[model samples]
Target: GEEVAQTPKHLVRGEGQKAKLYCAPIKGHSYVFWYQQVLKNEFKFLISFQNENVFDETGMPKERFSAKCLPNSPCSLEIQATKLEDSAVYFCASSQSGNTEAFFGQGTRLTVV
Candidate 1:
């Protein structure tokens, strides 16, 4: 695919439940990034992968958030014990390399209640 494809445009989760999101990066792109948009203009980088390897995950919450990019599979971000603060629009982006411009998906909006 030429564009990043994200599944389940919207998700509603109860507090303490689990929420998982999927992202299929553009074919041939080697880098995939996951970001959370809490505020309308703020995008916080959570994790990034170079191919199937973890690149950087400094911004990801160590306890409740986990992500993976695997061979021949759509990348995923999973949140365990969902919290109200976890409600946000998650954007998946992909690029040929770290330095290239990224192409983003429409995003998955997660709402925790």
Candidate 2:
């Protein structure tokens, strides 16, 4: 099992500002994912990448959210425009190909005020 690393445990931004979250996928794992948790029961899958190439992004917001998992760099999830509704815990996850469970990092809590 490998661990996903995330930076900046907390982020604060004003309305209309930008918020960026970073993730480091586990070594040897090819799939990396991002999710937004606004409530305990709700998790919105944001995007996924297979070794720097996007695999599935059906859940990503078309207008405001963007993500990348480029090689030799930390995977990043960014919100171009901050909103009060965007305040939430953003989680990063990673897994190896096939039959492997995904591992999540400590979420980055974003606050928009």
Candidate 3:
């Protein structure tokens, strides 16, 4: 079975500052995904990557959010110019395909003021 790992269970930042979250998908996984859970319920897809290439990022928040999948570096999500509404739990996941269930990491909670 595959799993995902993330660190810094919480983050706090002032407005206009930057926030970064980290994730490591289980070994052998080929696809990685980043999601934002603002409501603490439904997961909002942010971006996904296969190998080193981005598969899709249609759900990303324009201008403030960005993600990357670095070679041997796992994955990361960054938020620049944080806002009060940016408080949420960020989750990383890995899956073989969209049809399959994804393995989620222990989420990183971010709070901005």
lDDT of 2 by residue, 1-109 (tens): 2578898899999999999999998898999989889966499998888898998899988799999988889999999989999999999999899248989999899
Tens-digit lDDT track of model 1 for 1-113: 99899988999999999999999999999999999999675999999999999999999998999999989999999999999999999999999988989999999999999
Name model 2 segments beyond 4 Å from true.
none
For model 1, give the RMSD to the true fold. 0.6
How high is the CA lDDT of each candidate model? 0.96, 0.89, 0.87
Q: How far out, in Å, is residue 47 in model 3?
A: 0.5
TM-score of each: 0.98, 0.93, 0.92
Question: Model 2: what TM-score?
Answer: 0.93
Candidates by lDDT, descending order:
1, 2, 3
TM-score of 1: 0.98
Steric collisions counted per model: 0, 0, 0
* After superposition, candidate 3 runs with Cα above 4 Å error: none
